[model samples]
Target: MTGEVRRAETDVEREDAFAVRFEVFVEEQGVPEDLEVDGKDDEAVHFVGYAADESSDGSGSDADPRPVAAARLREVGDATGKVERVAVLEERRGDGWGRAIMEELEATAADRGLSTLTMHAQTPVEGFYRSLGYETTSDVFEEAGIPHVEMEKSLD
Candidate 1:
């Protein structure tokens, strides 16, 4: 997975990032449309992964522009960043795209002076986040009909 992950701050880029999440979570995972399309999008920092054309297997040209992964980072307070809506295309899973996105998100949060990062990870993926230095902070709860747990990590 030697692809580039781009951080998006502009409106168009954010929308494109959200679109990818919608496709994976809402459309494919059966998450309700409204629950997936939250109002926090506008205020969140988005990150996107584009399959590098240079790394294509020759099945398609590198000129094809497709977002294979995305994540959102929102400021929860003066020193906290909330990571949300992290999703990767089904076929792109297990290739490190998700971790890459989170790394970028943490860098962004640190750059913004945030010392702590938090997220509500779906139960099935909690271990994934935990492996990245996050620790569970709360009991599992239901979100959009899915089991999730709150996790946090300090970047200080």
Candidate 2:
């Protein structure tokens, strides 16, 4: 959270975001690559959070910030946007990167005139989303072989 979070504006930035997701979702959690790399990227606004204290990419450059967390926001109509693909490197958890990313996404949504945000959160992390003001709106369900619940937060 001490570093910076920015909307991905280049192919390389997007790739960095995806790399974090692949490490967390596909490699570490056993999610299939196909499911993790869904075709919606092109229509989403991706955000990448960087940490300057350490090198997440193994580049050994402490001075250069490296992507450590990522998430995407895509408008889903009725002035609401869906938050998706949230991921933080295993080493970066508990460092506030997840909250930082969500804050950035919420700020962007507000700037876009969105009145609410939604997400299908994995059950294990439902509490985390709730801490950010999201309320569960659905019973537990399965997605990508994991249990999940739909959650939403009003931006108004």
Candidate 3:
């Protein structure tokens, strides 16, 4: 539950994010590997979360920071951004990492003068986004063979 979430600023960190996506989307959800990594990664702003004290030896001191979650955001209109590829490792699902990730992303977007944030969320997890101040903006639809719907939040 304790970690740092920030916009990915290094190639290594971005790779970590991609690895998390592979774990959640491709391995767990059966999303085709071919469709998981889109061409937008190079230009999209990516976010990664890393734990400072996750340890296998139970010491929990100075262990290597491990990537736990990832997300992508890209500015679409003059004052809006599209968030995509949100992924959280199975172990971290109930610990608020997802919300923390979005919080960090929203903070970045707000700082950049973005007025809105948008995302296509899977049907089952739409409630999670709703809790974060997003509202459904589209009927249920499918993306990558998964049922999803567009959600949006004004950044005021």
Candidate 4:
């Protein structure tokens, strides 16, 4: 539990974030690699939660921080934000890393003066988001063949 979550501020950090995303969505969830990484990454701000005691590649190298979870956010309107790519390593789930990523994204949203924050949360994880003050705003819908629902929160 000795980890810090922060925005992915470097290209290498961004890659690490994507690696976590790929591990969760593409490798474990059976999502296509091509579909897992949408082009929106270029315009989104990414966040990563790194465990100080864990190694991402299992090499145990201190030079590279192990990123356990990741998420991204982008402006959808003048006062609205969209969240995406929320993922955590299977081994890291339920350790608060996912919520850590969400908190960082929410702080970023509020910093940018966004009044509303929205996301397409996988149906199975809707309760997780709900615990963070997000409310389901739309009925279940399929995205990438997986059931999802739109959720939102007001930054005010």
Candidate 5:
């Protein structure tokens, strides 16, 4: 990906990350309101991606980055990091922002002492996650009114 992706260090920064996710998953994709903003948001580490050209808006700018993406990672048990709320702006799909977000999230998971990364990927994008080394672990299921599949990848 040509964009720079990094973890948002503070609560306010994480909220901006969640805003991007809400734009895509809740507003655009029709994910349920309750599902889109789960309790995990308070506990997970959030990541945000912006086009290299975008100015550092001093933490979490409300302005849209040229190419924006977001995701959250939470510790699952003792060794796994669960990734959730991954989203990229509609116009930025083909530009590799999604993959950049995934890579950044994985790196964050690794840095947090997690040995595995897991996510429930929307069915349409399961292949994309698979290409990133995530392997399906369950049959298709409905989540937030969308079909999804559980997938996991080893951090090692």
Candidate 6:
């Protein structure tokens, strides 16, 4: 994928992140609104991925990019950060956008002096996290009605 990811530093950028999460989790995955938009976003660091909207260029010129994926990192204590709200627009999956978001978050975490990173990865995507150096730390459990497993990776 040739897209780019940036840390969300403004309200508008954060809203873009939330919009993608709403589409992927709430609308497509059947996750309830309350669970999808838990109120902890204010304390987290958000990242958004943008892909070029090629189809928007009817005149054959380059089109503006659109936010296609998003995730957040929240410090949960003990110098460990929890990765949360990971989502990529269905049409943009397999384009490496998800990995890009995680990569950015991991770098940010390390820069912030985090000793580790953790996430409750959905069961189906466990392998994805595994490939990124995260190890399953807990047995499968239910979160927001979806099967998940706790995974962690040490930064040190």
lDDT of each: 0.86, 0.92, 0.89, 0.90, 0.82, 0.90
- How far does residue 154 in candidate 2 sit from its true spot (Å)? 0.4
Give a tens-digit lDDT track for model 5, residues 1-156: 455788888676676687788889888998787887777777888888877545446444436454378888888788988988889888778788888888888877887789988889899999999999999999999877789999999989
- Given candidate 1, what's the lDDT at residue 73? 92
Off by over 4 Å in 6: 53-63
Q: Which regions in candidate 3 have their CA more than 4 angstroms from the true location?
A: 55-61
Q: Score residue 67 of candidate 2 by CA lDDT.
A: 89
The backbone clash count of each candidate, in order, is 1, 0, 0, 0, 0, 0
Better model by lDDT, 1 or 2? Answer: 2
Local accuracy of candidate 2 as per-residue lDDT tens digits, 1-156 = 568889999998899999899999999999999999889999999999888776755775666678899999999998999999999999889999999999999999999999999999999999999999999999999998999999999998
lDDT accuracy of residue 151 in candidate 5: 96
lDDT of 2 at 36: 92
Residue-level lDDT of model 6, residues 43-111, one tens digit each, is 999999877543233343336567889999999998999999999989889999989999999999999
TM-score per candidate, chains pooled: 0.91, 0.94, 0.93, 0.94, 0.87, 0.93
Over 50-155, each residue of candidate 3 has an lDDT whose tens digit, in order, gives 8776743445654667788999889989899998999999998988889999998898889889999999999988999999999999999999899999999999
Best-matching candidate per lDDT = 2
Off by over 4 Å in 4: 57-63
lDDT of 1 by residue, 35-130 (tens): 888787778888988776433344546665567789989998979999999999888899889999999989999999999999999999999999
Q: With candidate 5 superimposed using the best TM-score fit, by how many Å does residue 1's alpha carbon deviate from the native?
A: 4.9
RMSD of 3: 1.7
- lDDT, residue 121, candidate 1: 94
Q: What local lDDT score does residue 124 receive in model 3, on the 0 to 100 scale?
A: 88
How big is the positional error of residue 125 in model 4, measured in Å on the Cα after superposition?
0.7
Q: Give the clashing pairs for model 5.
A: none
lDDT of 4 by residue, 1-156 (tens): 668899999998899899899989988999998898778898999998898877667776645669889999999897999999999989888888988889889999999999999999999999999999999999999988899999999989
lDDT of 4: 0.90
